[model samples]
Target: MRLTLSNFVNYTSFMKFHYSILCILITFISYSQSVFDQDQVIEKTMSQRWELDDEDKNGTFKLTFYKPIFVLPARWSSNPNELPQSESLENSFTEVQNYDQVEAKFQLSLKTKLIQSFLFGHGDIWLGFTQLANWQVYNDPVSRPFRELNYEPELIVNFPMKVNLFGIDLRMAGLAFNHQSNGRDLPRSRSWNRIMFHAAFEKDNFQLYLKPWIRIESSDKDDNPAISEYIGRMEANAIYNKNKHSIYVIGKNSLDFDKNRGSLEINYLYSVKSNLRLHFQAFTGYGETLIDYNHKQTTLGIGISFIDW
Candidate 1:
């Protein structure tokens, strides 16, 4: 066949179109593979830890133990307030004024999935519980009494997704009904309930969680009416993992700059063994516990943390 001017023009156009399509396919495939590789890295890294409980396969009930679920012999808080005072009370538990400034802290935290791939195979149901206690073990005058205990329970529905926004991958979103309280009566009691919306984000070795909550009102049984003024309505947590060390920062704010009340907690963890980590934590702010919801304090503590969660 002999080539003409019109035929050569059409041939060039066809080649260009095919080349553009091939470039687009290559780009799409590269993006997909990158996402898949990242997901695999995260899953494998998390699977090696025993402290985390993973969801079961579709249409199954998975009950796994969340470890570092219990931390014993936690020590050090520069200041320990046995009874925190408010404007309503002239003196907060004056009887305990002689309480020791240093005591051991213990915590038990755990969670499990109740249902896997529920709601048209797009969501998961989970139950979680945590308890923290201050023990006067070294204070002989107190007979090693349990000074304070806060209990928390949560019901959560988590939906997983893969969406990238501004270089961050959104992994999951969830709603939770949470209740936290001190199991005490009258003047010593404190409790609150909230409906919270939470979401998870990740970029490289960094992960973040943002949770905002609305308080459920209890007309007659309101223990801490001004709790939100100090504890804030939203919380942000960030974690950075590298090599054998992980650092975490959690911040809460009332969203009112003028009032300016909230707290910040920083935690450092170093892997000491397969599932155990050396944990160092420092906190500055309000709502460290239910009883101290309105109190402001700075504390430092060191303990062992189970890294599986």
Candidate 2:
């Protein structure tokens, strides 16, 4: 209790020794715990943020609902040409007309994994569906009719990987069967099918997907016969996430170097919440939609997106 010099020095030394022992015990506990949980630490580090689902971590069927894959309201093409002309239909009705100069365009996409660990314990199967619609919301003459609805369904088999390729991590690879159609009758009907092979690569905050597809030729049931001529046989999608913003560029080409026909789409997204993002999109070239398969145009729009690549 008395403030003596000798007593104060003894008390200080005792406290210092106690503090050193406590720190040594904490370090030993931390090291031992890390060694005991080595498997968990490796699993967490290897898990990818951009993968759809990991079968080893996420069990059988996981339903991800109301996930907005690509949602944007755009100002679409005005003079929508390349109307499908059929001999069975009247020629007068099939003539190209000037559509609403600035119509509203929107897309809603969703996906879920129906089966997981299908084969080899590493592959997962998933089914994805998306719909894109063009609305003449502001056009008084058309009475705000839905101009076109393009439906897409895909069956994908994804395999996760950890291979290093040219300084980037090869994260995933898969094969998919894809079908897209605009549910319409006679002259307006458009549909196509493809077998697609895709791979995903990531480096730091950037991710890339390379998808090359082969058109499933259907001569008798072909609705949009020349669709491949513009939409292309392969596509490359790249995404970068940094500073609460995600930027994407998607491009497709027919690989016909002589013709040089392709399409390009750019998207910029700002994260507004944990699950919501403000999306701005611009597209130029052909195949913006089923009806606009052969028509080339440039469009820009802004909306909300719920998911990222």
Candidate number of the best TM-score:
1
The regions of model 2 sitting more than 4 angstroms off are 1-56, 65-71, 74-79, 82-93, 96-98
RMSD to native, candidate 1 = 24.3
TM-score of each: 0.77, 0.76
Off by over 4 Å in 1: 1-61, 65-74, 86-94
lDDT of 1 by residue, 161-236 (tens): 6789898888788899999988987567788899999887777778788999999988674778888899999999
lDDT of 2 at 229: 74
- Residue by residue across 1-309, what tens digits does model 2's lDDT show? 888999898679668755874585456335434543433211112243324445435554554422235445447553555354433243213565436756666565655676766676777777787888777655555455677898999988888888998899998898999999888876788788999999988788787889999999886756666667798989999978776687889999999888878899999988664535678888899888877777788888777665565
TM-score of 2: 0.76
